[model samples]
Target: MPAAGRLLAERHKDHRKRHPLLPAEYEDEQLAVVEVTALWESESASGAVLLEDSELTGYVLGAPKPSPVWGPNLWVEAAGQAVREPEHIRDLYAAAAAKWVDDGRTVQYVVVPDDADLLDAWFRSGFGAQHAHAVRPAPTTRLEPPAGLKVRRALRDDIAVLAELDLVLPKYQSRSPVFSAGELPTLEEALADWEESIDDQDYATFVAEYDGRVIGMSVGCSVEKSSAHSGLARPDNAGFLGYAAVLPEARGHGAGRALGEAVMQWSADTGYTAVVADWRVTNLLASRTWPRLGFQQTFHRLHRAIGY
Candidate 1:
């Protein structure tokens, strides 16, 4: 735990320069130090640190989470190297992963989208790219739907349609090496979530209707800086856009574009300055669409599964 803060300060400064597309997190150093200190002090987490002549050279920390939906219930919460001393990355990551293996954790998750060396280090430890987080400033443009299409807030009657589109993400991920269709929520589950979202003031669900039939859908909700799980975001008011999808027959129209624009405009009008969303790296439709919507790649959520 000692000197970890100092190491993080140097790493954070360099990370910002290398990943200008990511939102600022100047407080990450302090927050990381606090989190690591708490975990270390808890006596429940395991960590590995490489030292050179009694100075911290590199470090990796792991702790168990309450859930393990992604496989290994353990998480590599923090990892970094001192300025200009990246040689120990592989060893450090390996050491931490070894602890997970001993602790019966076969799957490990870590976010290192912007850190190539760190990502390489994790790759050496058996991790691979899983998901991506993207963000952009909320737009003020008043979006217009395609000919004969209309965009509106989804009502209770729209849950069935929205739930179907929600399956699109899982379907896309199911075709990739990093995911399984089983991970996606079932129609019942998706409908339940939509139903609950209706009561949440901070949440919004939008749909594009053509000829009175829902052809596309999008969902967004607010997340404060301190509540963000992705450390790539700045400590500012932000919103998350998700469940965005257009029916196969509706793709050529403007359903996807209109839904996206409306959600972003709603975010802006709701007083949020930035909006964040993510897609699997292999999700071609999302990969191409989000970028054109003005979102920039920010963080990559990488994963590795052992014995599965």
Candidate 2:
């Protein structure tokens, strides 16, 4: 585990060098060791390690998620891999995939750092980008809301409207390029969820209003509260922009951006140094908007399925 941690620490350093905005805490060797050990010791863990001259050079591991959106899937978590050479990952995956497939886990996903050569290696291994995690410094200034639109922290009174707005993103994803088949939460479920979140001190919900009607919404919370952002990609003292959606009629306007800015401002005021968010790679609007808002891609979730 110590050797694996050393390799991971080096990989993280390389990532930070290439993307200066990345958080520095992950480069800590001890933290990397602990994270790798947790995955390596999991009951269902399956992996491969490369050794040269009796020294560890690379490793890959994966385990099944408790309940995944995809069937019988294994996730190669953010801390699940490190390699001395980019091409060595191909060999690691080949060994790991055989064990995983024999276990009936045909669908697989891996969270990988944002490096062209590394991504190219994964691409050659039959993986393609499915989702992305990104981060940026919290903005110091509040962004101006779109003309005639008011952006403010959400209140209990906005629960019904928030529930309606919540369906917008999933609805959009159900059509066209994304075509996500995940079940959409009912309005009652959304309402119940928002009711809890609105009063939760750890959560901050923001809404964009036009003519006294809510047209968009965004939610922010500590990174520690989000399973996706709280793992290997998490930064120290960071906040997560967990959810955001805008009405169809409000599309052309800057309501989404306004709500996003409001989240960033909330994160900044709440003492977070950085903010992180993630989106489906095929969600056209989200894929484009998040990067445009200054969120730099840090890790990409790549996926591949065999005999599905």
Candidate 3:
């Protein structure tokens, strides 16, 4: 389509509009057009381009294996451009989803948070917000623990306690309408995850203690710049934060804050320049807490499930 470049340009422009603080790279639409067009050269990629009087009005490209988080389904790997024009977006998705559904795919995921019109189109086509990724510079704050508590790297024996903290996230999300409800992981699953983290040299796990009782936990690890989308994090020397939580009874006691500081401390000590993390938007506590700790929203993962 002659208008493909322009449509993709609109996508980049819309993204930068949604995130005003985004780095200057996002302002370069030509680069975005190059990246998006390259996906279409893949053999498995498929999509539709709508035209009104021979001008591209909308387009979508779907591909398998774009990510593991969305399960075994076709991801809307790249899509945008004139989507908000009446039924254009819904029609494009309808055409794309029909083929995937017939081929036995059951889910579709797309990342498009910065465009209100595009998001509205997605909502009209059955998509809902699922995840939010946030980032910030490695903090230098002098976070000291409360008088009765201390924070330090968690030992292997502390695996069980860290697993308990991991459960809080699922429990919190289960009650929030905006997040998918699901069964809590078994203790075995939680332990296995923590064990993998502990064994990885690049990862660090921390816990907060009060009178020798563990009250909170956090995990930090190196992140691959190439694996993350452009502009989501700095292009180099980045880190990723995993689960972090403090027990309900320990809310105001500084255990959570201390644990967070420990993660940032680990990032700095390990030579990382910035860190990334994600939390559900509907979880009221996290919605308030993460921003307060300086994590700025970078991208939103939108989900749509048309039952098989």
Candidate 4:
């Protein structure tokens, strides 16, 4: 296994398949994948650090729990790379695996039916099949909320309010940080820069207001994969109801559901045939709400860590 990533680039094909939408800068970001690995190495998430060779030619990433110790994740040198030496690679992951099993820990796994071979390898290696992650389908057509909360297209001025709401919601500390506090666009800033995001097509956000405040929101985007048809080979036509949040005070009043329903209708009316929304495993409200509005529970992406 000699520097195969550069010499036999094709061997890294599995990694590419694992992350198809990986931007050109696959290795960098504020929450860069590289930094995630390094930061969690000793944290709960680092299950075990295995090196293909004692020289550290290849390694694995995993985070063990307790304190959600090192961020639990895994990575290795590109498969075809020179570090693919069987004994070394096995020993490397084996060390981590031993620690994981002995520690009485479990890791979460997300897989597609088509990745049978990969799943086989994973299970054979002791990765248990956790509960399948689920998503909700967007409304197939546009439909209004119960008609009193005032559903309207979001205005430039509303970004601040919505951005404000974004600030107060519970921060789901998952492996991938899609909604960090700093990532939120301020109202005034988002207003001035609204034009920049509009041209992306199939991008729109709706809001529900009561007493002059942006009480609830329903934002949709076409960039995500849908729950109905997941294979990459399938045609892409669905969108995701990216943001559907309601203030706590508005919960039982049906504001959350209204906002969500309105967004599904908007998507359906706007030509999107499907809508998908992601909810953390612990969000009892979302887990229950979407299914009530014909948003069939689809799949989930779990977060786990290793360590005590």
Best by TM-score: 2
Candidate 2 residues 204-293, lDDT tens each?
889998888889999999989888875558887888899999999878678888888888888898899899999999999999888999
State the lDDT at 65 in candidate 3: 69
Please write out the lDDT profile of model 4 over residues 1-308, one tens digit for every residue.
Answer: 22222322322333335433322232222223333345344455443333434544444445433333323333221111122332343444566666655656544333322234433444544444432223334454447667567788777667666665554344432223333222444556644555455344556777887766678777776635334233321224556666677766666767888877776777677676555555544456766786677654332232333443
Rate residue 75 of model 4 by lDDT.
Answer: 25
Off by over 4 Å in 3: 1-10, 13-34, 41-44, 52-57, 64-72, 78-88, 101-106, 145-148, 171-184, 192-199, 225-236
Model 2, residue 60: displacement in angstroms? 0.6
Candidate 3 residue-wise lDDT, 92-171, digit = tens:
88887777888766677776645566677788888778667777777666556668888988899998888888887787
Model 2 vs. true fold: TM: 0.95
- The candidate with the higher TM-score, 1 or 3, is 1
Worst 10 residues of 2 by lDDT: 17-26
Model 3 clashes, total count: 0
lDDT of 4: 0.48
Highest lDDT model number: 2
How do the residues 1-308 of candidate 1 rate in per-residue lDDT, one tens digit apiece?
Answer: 54776676667667667545344554366765764576566445776888779887677676777644555567654342332455476677776777678888877766564666666666776678766767788777665666788998988888788889988767766775535535667899988887887667767888899888998888887755223344434425777776688877778777887888888888888988877777777677787788899987666667777886
TM-score of 1: 0.83
Question: Judged by TM-score relative to the true structure, which candidate is superior, 2 or 3?
Answer: 2
Q: Please give the lDDT score for candidate 1.
A: 0.70
* Candidate 4, residue 17: how far the Cα is off, in Å: 23
